[model samples]
Target: MIAINNLTFEIGARALYDEANWHIKPGEKIGLIGANGTGKTTLLKLIVGDYKPTSGTISKSKELTIGYLNQDLLSYASDKSILHVAMEAFDRQNQLHTEIETLLKKLETDYSEDLLNKLSDKQQEFEALDGYNIEYKAHEILAGLGFSDVDQERKLSTFSGGWRMRVMLAKILLQAPDILLLDEPTNHLDLPSIQWLEDYLKNFEGAIVIVSHDRWFLDKVINRTVESRKGKLTVYAGNYTFYLEEKSLREEIQRGEFKNQQAKIKQEERLIERFRAKASKAKMAQSRIKMLDKMERVDDVDDDNPSVNFNFKFTKQSGRHVINIENLGKSYPNLEILDHANAVIEKGDKIALIGANGRGKSTLLRIIAGADKTFTGKSDTGYNVTQTFFAQHQLESLHLESEILQELQTFAPKHTDTELRSILGSFLFTGDDVFKKIKVLSGGEKSRVALAKALTADANFLILDEPTNHLDMQSVNILIQALQQYEGTFIAVSHDRYFLDNIANKIWYIEDHKIKEYPGTYAEYEEWQNKRKLQPKTAAPAPQPKKEEKKPVVQQPTEDKSKQLKKLNQDLGRMEQQISDLEKEVKQLETKLADDSIYSNANKLKETNSAYQQKQSALKQVQQQWETLAEQIMELEA
Candidate 1:
């Protein structure tokens, strides 16, 4: 566990964290969330000692091990195979294996008892450390992260930055440190890999703090949430959804207190004025003034979630059919991206094209956007189909000499300055941030500017590839809301499920070298896909065994079946009741922990937190049991 006490960190003249305090408990999963420039990643770096705080201390036991995975690791290059790079986490076992090999070679000439004993010791140590299985473990993790068996044997330097980041992740996961600090772990992962990581991290023994913009991922993995705002860290007792509700409630209370304090101040000021004019009450008036001056004033809450009324004003509407692709065949020398793939995009169709990496999502987007002409099939754009395509490569089109506000002005010339600024603000460029030159912006910043520009185009159709890549949760929400109000046709390629579910009416995926369509939202598509996977596949029937030689039917006893069903139903009922009771207890404990008084009393806070966590664990166990029992009852009945 690590404790950050009164931590203060500054960049240049601005303070990122001002006396922020947070304690990371053992075995706890925490989601550190905030806007883009807030200090989520900075806190992780502070814990790992990569950056030092200006004041206060991050305390932990000397023996505690830490593993950090950040974007900076993308520059790490090695000639060794990815498997070898990951297996390097097992230092002791690898050393023992080398020693054992050396001893075996020495025995080929002089077979001394000392050499034999040394070899035995080394082998024993290696086996004790599970050295032989390390490679298997490494391979399993790498494959789970979307690496093929053949790719594992290739040199790490041969992979791209994104793939190399995956290799770094594999190495960090293999390290199995006491606490894992991941900054946007899902940024480089496709949908399948993200789900695999979610499952793996749920079963991970160590504590983890994830700094991510993926709201769905946080909801699936984190038990607690921490927000960094106004140079202070505030704890939310639950995940991202819970934090939203809790923060709203807290802000309501804060607003009420602020109003009441303002009224009280007015009353006190009137009384002081009335008494100050009287000779007899002069001393009382002075005392009242002192009291009012000493009172702690409550500050009103700021509206961080702004409502946008800026509409996307395009010049012309597209025809009924936005795009039409026929027998689309595209391939490279060693890879076939698409073959005889055909799809139709109609107007008003907000399509979400998604799949694992190495698929043809981007290529298809390019073809639809008319940026690629190498395909072997026909791709036509509908009438009056003016379009704007947004991708990572689009950043090159931006004028580096222009400022953020100036960049928006060029693309959205019809809009007022205030409207353009509002759009930029929604993308997290606020105040003087809009004045920064495009040349000085980082990749993420440039992505935001590009996305803002793309969304403001006068075209009737949009083709977006990974628009949510660099957006924070709030910015993504903004984009979702904007797209919801958009009347133009669009086809977007993204792995962000929340974004897809909120924006798209159809799901597109590539299968069997042909484009497939699911006429539903991403959530509905996921549910259907899951049920499809669970449905039993039909098998060929066994040859009718010579008419009368058929196997006799094995009939189960009615009494035993009835008893088993009854027991399962009874157990399920009990589990449901227990789960309900535990849920109440955990809620009550959470309320107790939320009290300001408890924080002032350390012992009370610790005891309440411990009880809350225990009840949560118990609730999870009983809920799982209830599910198992219900499944059993269903199977028996069937």
Candidate 2:
């Protein structure tokens, strides 16, 4: 529905697009991809009329409605509830509802024929717009995007920026625009949410242009790939994997053509040099020169080498057992997020922590990293185990006033300026970019800085939470390569399938307050899950020992043990619910504190902070109780 005709967009002296032409056909799902600073986002803006091309045209059908989900969350109504914001997407339907209400009120007063006719028209319009079920649709979209009913009712300001972006995305999807432009839409989503989005977009009835570093997401969601580089667009007929293969083949062919052309040019120059002074051969030399001048030079293909390499450095190695948790338990007041959990992590074990959002994956990581102190468990680090915890908020905690290079230097004060610069350069910070203040850097840039710091920390154990969220594909690949070769132990919470496939050798799946260990990659875990679903559920019990050989046992005691186990489980479940509820309240209050307007009102700010602190304290007490109960349960199990 959108046509880019000979588009040429320039920024000062830099040309982002030069006579670039591309088209978005109806129902075509295209992944817009390129290196960082290659104008992928700019291209989307150009299509959406946020930026005008220096020359040429981007024509769209007059009837087409476009929805653009930008990487940045700007001008959103923070005070409004998420559901309200989402419902605003159906403005026309809402207007019809308002009109119908007005007409009904007029009828109640003493309606004329004109008012009746107007009411009838509005009712028809409302039905056509599906106004009767707008609330249901909005709630469905919100729930699909991972928002609870209570969360939907909470003000948008309570959520983090990532979740706010999701809110915006829900609004766009609810609007059902003809063309959807998404830039890094999966950046903040967890695995479950990403899967939900994949399903939603797969069945989306519109043209989609998505710019994402998520290879699996691109492969699963898009039918085509569009690579924008050097102010030109190259279209691939298939998905991301197909694009890689086809692009490789095309490059090989181009190399051959380039080689042959170079050889011919060299021969022509040799002939010109040999016959330059002879009149008999002068015409021939002139002809060769003209041919050489007219020949088009082929541009070199981009190299895949990243500017920075993340070589995880460690000052010392940890003992065989990197981390050991026995009877680990954490809970909200009524919610038992984890109960009687036990796990032993060994040295060099690369574990991928996977689960639904808010299901304690990050919580477990924090506890392991020693960041969370309010947990009932025996958590012990092996000898000489130094850890670096790259939490989700790590980037936000960066000193925005510091320069990019300065940030890394602070992490590695012993390293000289030259060494620090070299490390920074490997991550793509070069020349002036190294000196650029962190405040001015983009989200991806800040992520790179955080990654660089993590690499320089010299820790033998790394606890990384969503490290690849803001990285580009190339950087992510470099990170995967580095992690694959890392000598240290790693426990990471990530949703990127490609990253997990390359890095994680074990999966620690958190489900229903327990950890399920799978000794394979994420793909294998998914396969195993799918296979389990297909297989019939008839698990055979282990055979009992022969009565003659079996030792005498206390039947009453055995029965009592079973009853105790069941009771413990039931109590754990209740405590977990209580904890979850309390935590949710604390989160909502924190979100309220996050609002700028709330801070401006001193009384409200104090009240909210006080409530948050009180909830935190109450949750801690309940967690302690849950932990004590967990210890008892663990003893019983033992």
Per-model TM-score on C-alpha atoms: 0.82, 0.79
Let me know the TM-score candidate 2 reaches against the reference structure. 0.79
How many clashing residue pairs appear in each of the predictions shown? 0, 17
For candidate 1, the 10 contiguous residues with the lowest summed lDDT are 536-545
Top model number, TM-score:
1
Stretches off by above 4 angstroms in model 2 are 111-117, 276-287, 305-315, 333-335, 396-410, 413-422, 430-440, 532-638
lDDT of 1 at 508: 94
The Cα error of candidate 1 at residue 31, in Å, is 0.9
Candidate 1, residues 293-367, lDDT tens digits: the string is 999999999977765567887888775557767778999789899997767687799999999998888988988
lDDT of 1: 0.87
Q: TM-score of the candidate numbered 1?
A: 0.82
Candidate lDDT scores, in order, read 0.87, 0.85
Residue 29 miss distance in model 1 (angstroms): 1.1
Q: Highest lDDT: which candidate?
A: 1
